[model samples]
Target chain A: MEPRSSGLVVLVLVCPLAAAVLLQLFGRLDRRLCMPTALAACLASLSLTGVLAGNVARGMPWVYHPGNWGGLGIELKMDLLALLFCLLIAGLASLVLVYSYRFIPHELAPRETSYYTVFLFLVSGLLGLSIAGDLLTFWIFMEVMALSAYVLIAIIDVPHAFESSLRYLFMGALSSLAILLGVVLLYGAAGTLNMAGVLGVVRAGANGQATLALALCSVGFCVKGAQVPVHFWLPGAHSAAVTPISAMHSGLVAKLGFYGFARFIFFVFGTTAAVGVLKMTSVLQWIGALSILYGGIMAILEDDLKLMLAYSTISHIGFMLLGISLLSPAGLTGALFHLLDDGLAKACLFLCAGIFIYRDGTRSIQQLKGIALRTPLTAAAFTLAAFSLVGIPPTSGFVAKWYLVLGTLQARRPFFAAVMIIGAMLAAVYAFRVVFYMFFAPERSGALQMDDVPPAMLAPAAILGAGTWVLGIAAIWILPHIQRFVASLVS
Target chain B: MSQALSYFNLTVAFTVFIAGVYMVATEHNLLRKLMGINLCGAGVLLLAILTGFVRRGQQLADGTVAGTNTVVPAMQWLAVAGIVAITAITAVGLALARSHKRVFGTMDLDEKRNGVKQAPPQSTPNATEDRR
Candidate 1:
């Protein structure tokens, strides 16, 4: 990275933080400026990311060590993968900020100012994590994300929201501790905090300390990912939060876990198949497989619309984890592609679910029946999203699933291939359950009585719904970029 | 005895972490759970200090070398970062517990869940006026 590009990278990471601070100051003067100010910051971030992506398109990653003290301070690395995620987060966040204009209740006026501040702050954390070049910076940004999420969940101020937010706090604290412990161990083994430096050190040779560090790190990340025992917190957290938040949590926050996992395994560890480390990748595969089946089964049983999407998120996370663990080029590419694919689809799905709740004032799956006749556009948007989630052809979801299945075959894991197919089948079962109820179930309560939600809400969902296919159609170009990214990171 | 002395800090840190996890697992009190989380953070904080402790390159009295030391002052910064994180988390956790207590009149999670207290007053009555 040249000086100019590196400087822009810093701005890209700092823009949201700057906007957040500005919002806080202006919040005292007028409360109405919060949304536009946040949106402006997102625009700045998106443009800055465009510059950094231009840099990434040129060559290998360039680490920008702030203060130029030879990396003694925080280092920010820019690359194709980081740029992709930054764009997704910033772009979606802008839309969410816009959606909050009419979507957030006017009663929460006093709270809305602080909401935008924290919301922008959260966006800063996500962008920071995307480009963080070292584990300490990574952990700090992860904390930022987790802390803001806790506040956002509780911001709804209902009793159930409080309960769920507190539980999320407990879980977040535990995960942070776990990751901190791992970082300490890694420092002990490799005397360096920078991830690329860790790779260099580990490649030189890893003893028992390196092995223990790997185990500790994986445990921390799995908790963040919400694979099994730790995953029980997600449904409650998602259900208790509002729609825009639920979309952010499901779309971007969950994908960040896979981002961290890929960073550690492919970049920091260098993918060299260290004798003991190979075993960890295999273990990751097993965890992925288990989560696939578990998330599928759980989603099938969920009666709440939001909770079902939450569980479906976990299952798709399983697919990404499975892709990363496979350690094949095709698998890594699939994982990255799917991260984008699922983010768009799920954001659309959750936003449409928000419209359902808004129109019908209920989240129960049964109560949502006959909603389609009432609001055909939202129902249509949702069905399109479902097709994406179920991996129907012409959506990005199918492209990602196709590559994932091929990656599994490449790794010679036919069983996981079967798991992918079976999981998608289960996804079809649950996704269409909503569709059938919305369109086919007879109207009992005369609920087809209102027009669709206001366009402020519908526009974002429609765009994201279109994004799922746009990404799919553009996959021919996008997949090659992802392949190049995986090659650069792993090598 | 020599081996025990050589690995003392690592063992102590690990032990503290286990104890914290045990507290978290066994305790139902919300404050106690927060304390448990603090204990866990303390254990990790100790480990962070140990990452730098070997930089002085001292030999044990039993003559076992304390391993190579690179004089990484960066590790101390890591410890400082950990402390800041703990402080923020502690503030948030206390705030949450205070809210929990006001709502339920007790610190037990099970009691809160089982409806031992009155349901919270609704924020917007007409928002859900029609829904069952």
Candidate 2:
């Protein structure tokens, strides 16, 4: 069992990494093998995550220590929550891999080698990040994730990709510095870097040093999370990447920031220290509120399809953070649920957007009229995803919004509830505008017949799009289990 | 001597940090910003090293005075840090060179944006109606 658990952890990580190397090797031998090889590797990791999730669910949180250092080894600790997030990371990457089968050669061409390689590196980094049990390893894996993301964005061979990737790299470095300093400060205060040890110190009413560490960590994570003032780099970076890369960045990578933030801030620092001593919860609440309004307004004003989706990522993640900041059980559950919901919904939307661009070779929304007539299934997926984004009933977006509203009311911040409602309305405005124009608006005269993307791409989009409804209905059962998890975590 | 070394590290770390912040905030030059980031990273690494020092009398499990008596080599940590930093810097540097050479047709660090760049015609079709 020991060998198996450790092997499972290493396998979960090494699968994608090995595939990255093999994909490069295979691509050199036969270009056609790249997609299948990449998909197989991602699927292997996904299946491993399922096993890890099962072990965690059976009340045995697997902790694999490579060196078996008595108490201080860098450990891959997978609690139920971490396993849940790992499932998301692995599942999302596998789908993106499927989505990229036909999309990559069409877009990346000769550069497909670097494209798939860096993408697998990113997936490995994200999986490693999901189970990070200490600050040192967390920072290491986080940089792995960030550096690969920078490379992914830059290698897309477009002028915009160049500028945006450079800007993103600089901003990313700043966030890393913040996180490093925070970790150093925390270790200084607590004399240990272990998550559980840090939690012990924080819960014992940590001194000024610990509070400062928390502050630095929040700033760093917020910037990486693309919370408003530091969020300028995100729209540029997300929109400029190729669409599949955009999905990975928006749907997967940004969630890393939130994961580290929650693991440290709430679970380690303890919410009371953050709220009472640091007076941070309210500050974060304000940041969340600002991001929601700002992201919504900007998204509504954007004309490019990918740009609109990029801004929507900002707005939806804002909703997640807002739920977290409420400091209520429902809020945390809602935040976690929204993490899964928004990630899949946005991925589906971006893939559908990619199909549109693939077919017409245009990204401007004005030129995308009557797309529903062109490809009914893809359009239907886009519309479902759009409705999910807008919080329509029986969709995951609605569930997230409902829980968040309840969280605010329970927190006795009725004003915050109002802000969320307003944000949702703004979301509906932008999302429905795209939907209306694409499906309802008249097609320009002389519109050529357009076909849906190949089943390779459409399968992933349809699955994720349908995931919008499945996850919403699933949330009713899922939230209570998440509540139990959050309850245990906070206690 | 140890006290002086600590003070020296503090002063240099902070000086570098501030200088980096100033460079990043005020300068539009891409090279300057990159330099700022490197400076900031140096300050941070230095600070981490500073935090590693054991106090004057804190001893090891074997009862020998720690850190003060003799240095415990952090070779592994340094090596790991070195590799990560070098990889990141190399990647970014190559990208900078590629961008400059590809776009401007020169290695000059100065941006050559003319007044025409200010108006910034929307290169993609119909992408620029909204100002908000």
lDDT of 2 by residue, A274-344 (tens): 88876888998999999999999999899999999888888887888888888887777778888888888
Off by over 4 Å in 2: A1-6, A445-452, B1-12, B55-57, B61-79, B106-110, B115-132
lDDT of 1 by residue, B1-132 (tens): 144543686789989987888888788888899899889989998877766665346653234565776335567678888888888887888877766665566678776668676655534522421132
Best by DockQ: 1
What is the Å distance of residue A71 in model 2 from its true position? 5.6
TM-score of chain A in every predicted structure: 0.96, 0.96
lDDT of 1 by residue, A199-255 (tens): 888877755556766777777778777887568778888878988899999999877
Please report, in order, the local distance difference test score of every candidate based on alpha carbons.
0.81, 0.78
Off by over 4 Å in 1: A1-5, A71-73, A273-275, A444-450, B1-6, B54-71, B113-132
lDDT of 2 at A194: 74
Top candidate, metric lDDT: 1
Candidate 2's TM-score:
0.91
What are the TM values for chain B, all candidates? 0.67, 0.53
Candidates in order, TM-scores: namely 0.92, 0.91
Top candidate on TM-score is 1
